[model samples]
Target: MPDWLSLYYEQPIELTHGEGRHVWDAEGNRYLDFFGGILTTMTAHALPEVTKAIGEQAGRILHTSTLYLSRPMVELAERIAGLSGIPDARVFFTTSGTEANDTALLLATQYRRSNQVLAMRNSYHGRSFSSVGITGNSAWSPTSLSPVQTLYVHGGVRGRGPYAHLGDAEYIAACVADLEDMLGQTAGGVAALIAEPVQGVGGFTMPPDGLYAAFREVLDRHGILWISDEVQTGWGRTGEHFWGWQAHAGNGPPDLLTFAKGIGNGMSVGGVVARAEVMNCLTAHSVSTFGGSPVTMTAALANLTHLLEHDLQGNARRVGGLLAERLRAVTAGLGLVREVRGRGLMIGVELVRPGTDEPSPEAAGLVLEAARERGLLIGRGGTGGVALRIAPPLSLTVAEAEEGAELLGQALHAAQDHMTGRRS
Candidate 1:
């Protein structure tokens, strides 16, 4: 593996198998999986519906590319287009979120006839050359060179930025003003302003609701496209809305949107959705051979069906609320915990140096290690790796949420003691 390849835990355990919310390591120790393989396992591990779909599809045929008629692919696309809420929306499937965002950028740039893009500060899109260029996190984006003339904007991270101390209304005005100023500096019309509804890799950070709606007014005036990168916050994971863009309800929807992560329930499924005009901008033929493979499509169809049939979105709202309350209660008054924020199952617990707001990556690491030892698996995020990411599967039951919270509480206290030299 390359040195840059990221892995969790100082001593990563090899997961052998899993069922529902629990997984067993090579040593046969069971763990309650909170991160869901970086939020890819949407429904549950080894779900019978998804597994059966793959099995049944595999028996018939697998690799019929875009050259032929694909029922499963079309079906999945139709469902996504309808759910996306973009009028006359068109869908294009890819193998990952990176490719999905890349395709959205391609369409936006081509349709607008400009290579310039507007991205949020402290945001992460993906690792592809084009995606990396727009990513605002320096830790992830290794290159300064980019295909598009990318301009980083504010209003993504709320509490730590220049406008953090301002009241909500004042902060919104400041961010909107900053955005107007940034646009004035741009030489030509920007192709699009792409954003993650919740900056996932930037540590589940997000701005006040409707911040994007305010920016939408500016984009609309300049005829610049708004692209919501819902790769992490999509599929009702946020609970309040199916799509993250819906949080900014004043604006109808974005011109373009990208989705991946949980849609396939561990299957490699991703795609871009846009109004017909934007999606059809590509002149030449473009196809992804392995993108809409029957096997993957079947898995996605089944997984999506299960998600809706079970009303897992409601499950996310109810169980996630309980989990959030538990987390806030446990970490309250702790010197190392800065804030507890996030919606639904996508929660982030920001850690700071004891008695200070400065990010404490060391404390976060200790909490992660302690949690793992207690048979729990969580994730870490944020620019400085100071946020504990807690996103369990949407299908998580109330009992599992309670159990995970208790274990996490114990881990946090242990981490606090170790950090303060109470434990040697």
Candidate 2:
């Protein structure tokens, strides 16, 4: 593996197995999995329904190219199309989020006949060449060389920006004005605006509600497509809405919506849902050989069924609300804690230096290590990696949420103590 491929912790532990919201490491220590494998294990770990579906499908057939008519693929696509809310929706499967975003970009650029694109500042779409081109996070985008000309827009991160001091309504207006200005400055009709509904890698930061809807009006006038990258925030993770874009449903759905992570419940399943006209814009032949493998589709179908049947979205709303409240109460007096914000199950706790506004990645690292010590696994993000991301499975129980919150509270205090040199 490349040295650039990073791992968590001062000494990373190998997870051997997991069930529900807990995972056991190679050292035989069990930890409550708060991050959910970067929010990929959406429903749960070792979910029996998904596992059984995978086994049953594998017993029947494992591999088949897109040339063949796969029932599972078509069925899953149908389910997604109905759920996607895009009129005359078309679904295309991919093996990962990067490929999904890449496909969306391909469709948008081809349809608009322009390579210029709009992306959100402090956003992360994917890691592929095309996806990276529109990624606004400099830390993630390694090179300036990109296939498309990307013009980044603001309003992704609410608390830390030039317009941070403004209220929600004012903030939205400012971002909309900024976007209009950028669009006017652009040379030609831009292909699309790709954004993470809630920035995953940027410390789970998000704009105020309805920010995208405001931008949609401007894009509509220019015939620019809106691509909502819901890789991390899809499938009812946000709790309040089934899809993140639904929060901004003042306008309808986006032209393209890319989803991955959690749909397969650990299986590699990703896809793009777009309006038929935009999706069919590709005049050339295209197919994902391993994109919608029967086994993965089966797993996704079973996983999705379980999610809906069990009303995990409602669970996310109730339990995530409790968890966030608990965390806020615990971190309220802590000087190192800046803010705790998020919706549903996806929450971010920003850490700053003691008695200062400066970001403290060191404090975040310490908190991660401390959380591990207490048998809780979380995640880190943000431009400077100063925010702790907590996103457990949608099936996370209220008891589990309480347990994880207590453990995290202890971890936060421990991190603060370590940072202040009160603990040697």
lDDT of candidate 1 over 61-162, digit per residue (tens): 979987788999999999999999999999999999999999999999999999999999989999999999999988889999999999988888987978
Per-residue alpha-carbon lDDT of candidate 2 for residues 1-424, written as tens digits (9 for 90 to 100): 9999989988989999999899999999999999999999998899999998899999999999798999999999999999999999999999999999999999999999999999999888889998888888888999889999999999999998899999999999999999999988999899999988899999999999999999999999999999999999999999999999999999999999999989999999999999999999888887779999999999999999999999999999999999999999988899899999999999999999877899999899999999999999999999889999999999888899999989999998988887788633
Q: TM-score of predicted model 2?
A: 0.99
Clashes of each: 0, 0
Off by over 4 Å in 1: 422-424
lDDT of 2: 0.93
In angstroms, how far off is 120's CA in candidate 2? 0.4
Off by over 4 Å in 2: 422-424
Error of 2 at 201 (Å): 0.7
> Which pairs in model 1 have colliding backbones?
none
